[model samples]
Target: MKVIKLDAIDSTNDFLKALASQDELDNFTVVTAENQTKGKGQMGSKWQSESGKNLIMSALVKDFLYNNEQVFNLSIVVSLAVIETLKSFDIPNLCIKWPNDIMSYNKKIGGILIENTLKSDGRIVSVVGLGLNVNQTNFTELPHASSLAVITGNTFDKDILPALIIEKIQEKIGLWETNSTDFWKQYFNTLFKKGIPMPFKNGAGQNFMGIIQGVSSIGKIQILLEDDSVSEFDIKEVQMLY
Candidate 1:
């Protein structure tokens, strides 16, 4: 798990995609940038960063590591990995919002982006990119953002951030290697809501309030409503309101 550190780049994920196009690469190969000029997030949303104060990195994983069914679970696995890693740094009260946002004290501190590519050999490659706020203190203009330093009131050494995150990713990634109950349990425990009615807009542009029941094995968010009937949503099929 060696990180190919960069002074700056457009997008680490794009850089690694080019590497995948050029030649064979090893799994767990990380490409991190000091600053990203054109970073994209889920739904092709922009992933903005404050250059040196944040963690901007992406990992290229080979097909043998995961498949379609496993890919959805991987998001939960990776998100949990990040949440646990931040906790290890003494950043408590960390919670994972549905899909891939890390929230603390009701504010966002990090985000994860997962991309899938198919190879000519009938295998899938997952490129997982992560953007975590680590040491910045001036996000007042960026309202929805906060840094680890702000929450913990201590600065993080950027030099070792990527490696530590990658190590945690590998550990959580291994949970998929076996049918570990803790994987799902950890994800569920960190779930955004237990039984309270949460406002959400489905992918179809419909707004509804449904109590989040837990994520299904198929990765769809299972929402239990006031009617006692359950409605399941595929990934990206539902979005929670701020």
Candidate 2:
């Protein structure tokens, strides 16, 4: 539960990974940055956040029983944690867009980037990085981005948010050993646009309509297409077009 706060950093995920390389860190050790110069998103995209106005953090989980086969479980846990935290704020329309983006009112307010290092023995060390738009109100060039302040019309104290999110994450992780079946069920129930027709584009740049059937344990998305056939695609293999 060691928490390190930084005024500025290149990326919290990179910082925590460097710390893990240097010495052993306690499970749930967190690094938070007020300003990230090169924050990352899924597929190597840049994550933009106004300095001192959002939640930019990464947490380290060490020596887990999780193997490569169950990697998607981490995504479920972390995504549900963020969604639960936002629900506590009474935020409206909180839904997880497949793979790992948090959306509110059909716009993205947060995202996750998880990196895992596998040990020789089958255990995994995960570095879960997250960015939540907290108090920022202006997105400028990024039209699809929104923030807590923008969504709620009230400013939030950004300083306390990272800790709260970590606490929620810990609570979810604590339940993994005892109630995994029910836990993952709830995660699936929150999938954005589940069972509803939506526009999507495949890797070949072909557009089609489909419904989100639940995500696979390995993190691939299962889509029920217009013709009633089901197919699973990995991240970047499919894109949701809103």
Candidate 3:
């Protein structure tokens, strides 16, 4: 997997797709930009990344192992990859929020966004994009936002960190694909909350108090609600809110 660094790009995902469309992108090829002018977030929200302060990169992946709704799990892989990478820095007290957000001290340090581009034959061509706040101090006033430097008090950020993170990503992806239980256990350990019952909302706006039972192979999360009943949801079907 060759990682391509750019001085600036509008969006790594867009760049990768343009290349993929021209048959230029290979699986595991990475495109990272110093700044993304039009970076996107969940639900078309603008991803606010100050220039040269965070990781704005996209990875090309051809995951044909998914069926129907399960295809979105690449974001999960990318999220877990980011979490593992941060841990390599010995950054303490970091946690993985439900779905795809990583946090430190209850504030989000970074996130993953995965987009799928298809071939004419219906094969899945995914561009997993990560916007992890790395070397930065202040950001536009957002409560759930932070950076690696801000969290770990490190003076340096992206220069030496991206390579380390890429290595961790490869390791995590391999482990997650082979041993699902081990992946779940390790992911659960870094969860913001696991055993304790907490209030959560789903996509339908219904609320429930439940324990996050971690991720399932189906990519749905198991929620053991206060009623002693268990329910499962895919991605945005459940949103954990404190």
Candidate 4:
């Protein structure tokens, strides 16, 4: 539970990854920054946040996944952890967009990017980076983005939110080992737009209609197509056009 607070950094994930390479980091070791000069999102998207107004942090997780194939399970655990934390604050309509986008009222509020490294000894360690919109409200240029303050009309203490989220993560990390069936069930339940027909765009920018049935064990989204055939798609292959 060692927490390092920084005034600003290029990226908390990069900082934590560098720190782990030089020294031994305990499980759940955390690095948080007030501002990230080069914050990143899924697929190289930029994560923009006003200084001191959001929660930008990374946590080190070791000895979690038994093998590389179980990597998506870690994503499920972390995504559910953030969703549960926000639910505690009574954030209305909180749901996780497939593969780790935190949403509220169909608006984007946060996201997760996980980087896993396999050690020479075959151990996998992950740096889980999270960016949550907390108090920042100005998203005029980014129409789909909104903060907790904007949604609830009340500012939140960024300091407290990360602690709660980490605590929630710690509580659920063991579920992967104990009860994976129930673990996946919880994640699917919180999945945004599940079981609903929606429009999706492919990598080639072709639009099609499908329903999100669930995710594969390897993390691909399983979509029920218009022809009643279920198809699996990698994250890069499909984008929800809601």
Best by TM-score: 4
Residue lDDT tens for model 3, 15-35: 988888887666688889998
lDDT of 3 at 165: 66
* Candidate 2: residue 46 Cα off by (Å): 0.8
Q: Per-residue lDDT of 1-242 in model 2, one digit per residue for the tens?
A: 68999999999999999898789788899899999999999999999989999999999976554668888888888899899889999999999998889999888999999999886676799999999999998898999899999999999887777778788878877888888888778888888889889999999999999999888878899999888899999998999998
- What TM-score does each of the candidates earn? 0.92, 0.96, 0.86, 0.98
lDDT tens string, model 4, 1-87? 789999999999999999999999899999999999999999899999999999999999998876888899889999999988888
Q: Clashes in model 4: which pairs?
A: none
Clashing pairs in model 2, backbone N/Cα/C closer than 3 A: none
What lDDT score goes with residue 181 in model 4? Answer: 86
Superior by lDDT: candidate 2 or candidate 3: 2
The regions of model 4 sitting more than 4 angstroms off are: none
Best by lDDT: 4
lDDT of each: 0.81, 0.89, 0.76, 0.93
User: Looking at candidate 1, what is the lDDT of residue 36?
Assistant: 95
lDDT by residue (tens digit), candidate 1, 1-242: 76799988999999998887787888889998889999987778888888888899898877444456666777876898788778788887888877778988777889898888877776888888999888878886778788899998899886776777778777766656684577888888887665679888988898888898888876778998768899998766888876
User: Using lDDT as the measure, what is the rank order of every candidate, best first?
Assistant: 4, 2, 1, 3
